[model samples]
Target chain A: MTSHPPAEGLKVHVLPAPFDPANVTLITQGAEALLYRTTFLAPSTPAALKVRPQKPWRHPTLDKRLTRQRILAEARVLVKCRKEGVPVPGVLGLDWEAGWVVMEWVEGWSVKEAVRGWEKREGARQSEQERGGYEIEGLLRRIGEAVGRLHKAGVVHGDLTTSNMMLRPLGSGGAGQAEESGAGSLEGEVVLIDFGLATQATQEEERAVDLYVLERAFGSTHPRSEGRFGVVLEAYGESYKGAKATLKRLEDVRMRGRKKNSKDYPPAVLLLTDLEGTVAPWPDECDSRTMHDREEKRRVPACLQPYQKAESYTGAGSNPYPPHAK
Target chain B: MENITLPHLLEHPLQVCLFRNVENATFLRQQLLDGNTKFEYAFLDASVLLSRKHVLAACFRAINDMLNDRLKSRNVHSEIVFSLSPNNNISESFRRFGITNESINVLAIKVGGDAAQIESHLTANVKGQPAVFSDEVLAEVCDLSRIKKIYRVDVGTKSDGEAARKEAEAFVLGSMALKGS
Candidate 1:
């Protein structure tokens, strides 16, 4: 007969022995580790503790290195960004030994949820065509504006999906959607979350690729995206130097690549946006076998080396979205 | 098993000089005899005494030297030693013994010998405990113990140096006694 354990104390290490199994709430469990909302007592604080799987399939040494690097890198990036006046969470504490990062827990729905909520509301209000355009477009434009500011501060949102933006309340009891844009401080702002892939960059191409990825995310997730996307570009243009020209060149290269090999260019609307001129042309124009070979060469004049070099400069090699490079 | 408080020991100079360090003993005696705090220069050799009585008599002789030669009445003694402990609870003990100012600097020297048994003892004691003591409590205990200096603590169990092991044991025992008292 097993005796019931006592209700655990306030502050508890998320390890063996004293850990109460009942108190562990699993948020998302991945191959690497499981994330749990754990409570600690002495001056009681609730923290999201991402614990590595006790028995990992990967090699232990490599996994440990990866864990150390990821935790350190995330903390370093956030601290640097915060110092630069970026709206990022303050690091509460860090224990490399435990591989746990304690950060300020944000309270708000993700942009995806917000968009879905608006879609549901519009669905109730009208028919499909009438429902599609205005409201969702407005939401995407706001996301774009947020992305523009991030780029202006030379911080790239490595993973710029709608899921990463939290649509928090406007602030101080007002129902209006006021935010912490480039004005006096507004408490309830639409903040970009998840700095897992974030890194500092000064290159235009790198910034362009970041915008490209977010544009694709907007198009794929929301309806009637083109005009809303233009609004985003408009804001980005206002924020980023020579942004419209760079975007135009990026679009031209994207079109040439599409005609040359349709297979390489997936039918994703935002695919053109993510092409940051990172792919370079052959040093000697060696491969002329492709269909739109001439057109491709004409669009990317300095080849893709300069652009790819720029990408490398911005710490894109370590990005997790396409893990092979790192 | 009770530890002596540092401040209390300082109140009686002759007793402290005899039991503490030979150098400290010599310095205090000279200061007492001189009846002054200002120093030009003074020197005394404590190791030359032929017997225990010779040392006590020498201490008295040194006191006269301080009074006649240096013109100082105040004596402050400073000494350094090394020890390893399972816990740093002496500071709390010092506070409890009423040594209000708790800022004492201690630097630890690592001893490769006598680590295993020390670690085993520490593991047995604090393997699963929390919120043990306040800094004030630790300082109070340290003051009460009269251990003005310490170093080379092996808080883990992997036994190594014979001499250092003994020293660490004495330090730990002294601290424990202070806690109990």
Candidate 2:
């Protein structure tokens, strides 16, 4: 979850249900949900309460139904993951009508913070430092496997970033495995969180996109560790049955890129005609009666013509189509 | 009887009493069926409850529903039983969680009532020895197999022992919390 300064105006929206603002401390002001650190079930038991406030601009009925669906969707996905033995925070309590969901509090720092901390310490000793230690590789591998397990359970986390994963300290959790823990400490299970955007889908394309988003996120967020990202993919490749196929699809996703860059076509490009091909289209403002009444101006690549000398046609007899379209 | 006030639910403090070797289970169940106002306590069979937190979670939900006027059952006491349920069926919840005629261990809970009145009334009515209300004590009284069957958990094949139990509890809590959604 992207953390920002708590929106002061949001503090005015009293917490839904019995949770009073006085008792629930605001943790972050996300674009969609307001997260709070509060006690649920019992006073000593800590929980994360996510409140989706009402959008006053929408009709009250629609707003309520929308909020309820979102809350239920997140909670249902979380419960399913927990039942499948996925490392995720369990849903402790949920009040969809109140637009709030309380989840078991995951302790320890986020993977983003942990990685950055490691990077900072490693850079300080750069003179004799070796890039990518065993611990770091293990951590990345763990992250990959955690994600693989989630996907294997037939769910895709729409947003897969380091910040969304938590490193719950180990050893205390079970019996064995007293691993080393000091500087660049990554000794914990990678617990994925934030199911707000997750969906139940086993299609390889969606899974590939999920991984693509993570790859891009990891590269941009931790450029220094980008080189070791391959280790994560390698681990993910072996984690499940269709994982290799998903990785293969990841190659195609990378080629297309994340944005719809079709608009960046040189000056003018062919807009499909006489066909079912449909997408963002240029306005066809001229009617049958007005086709000859209006002068049509079109863009030509600057290489061929200057902007001031752009070609203009008063009627359909002149060229009919732009040179660029051909 | 112990006075328990949950966080965010201080307005509805609870008075809970745990009983062991209850011989009057039939009588208590009868009073509830008779709709006796004097027995306005949430009489739960401790066998179905995993731990103190499990029981209190139901209490918190029931009280919150009452506060918001969303109680699905008759009142807060019956609502507590319904809250323990993982579905919207009220009678099924009562049948599974509510005190049974053969219940050996019983948990008597009174919400927002006179503490002295509840304690005296419970002691005079419930024909059993009062036991400490603790997780360890509840663990002894709780039947893991019954809990697994009720929550539909396959904890036996998962991990076994404390880890398995913890996993089961998390799933059970999740199911209970997400009920009716």
Task: Identify the candidate with maximal TM-score.
Answer: 2
DockQ values of all predictions: 0.02, 0.66
Model 1 over residues A80-150: C-alpha lDDT tens digits? Answer: 55444455554433434346554444455677776666655666765667664465555556666677677
Quote the lDDT for A44 in model 2: 76
Residue-wise C-alpha lDDT for candidate 2, range A1-326, written one tens digit per residue: 12355676744665776877778887887878999999976777888999999887899999999999998999999999999999999988888898988888877778898899888878877565464466689899999999999999999999999999988777444323324454236778889999989999989999999998999899889989988899999999999999999999987787678433343222232434532356434334422344455565554453475333245543566544433322
The global C-alpha lDDT for each of the candidates, from Candidate 1 onward, is 0.43, 0.84
True contacts kept of each: 0.00, 0.80
Where is model 2 more than 4 Å wrong at Cα? Answer: A1-11, A126-132, A171-184, A258-326, B157-159
Q: What is the lDDT of residue A266 in candidate 2?
A: 27
Estimate candidate 2's alpha-carbon lDDT, on a 0 to 1 scale.
0.84
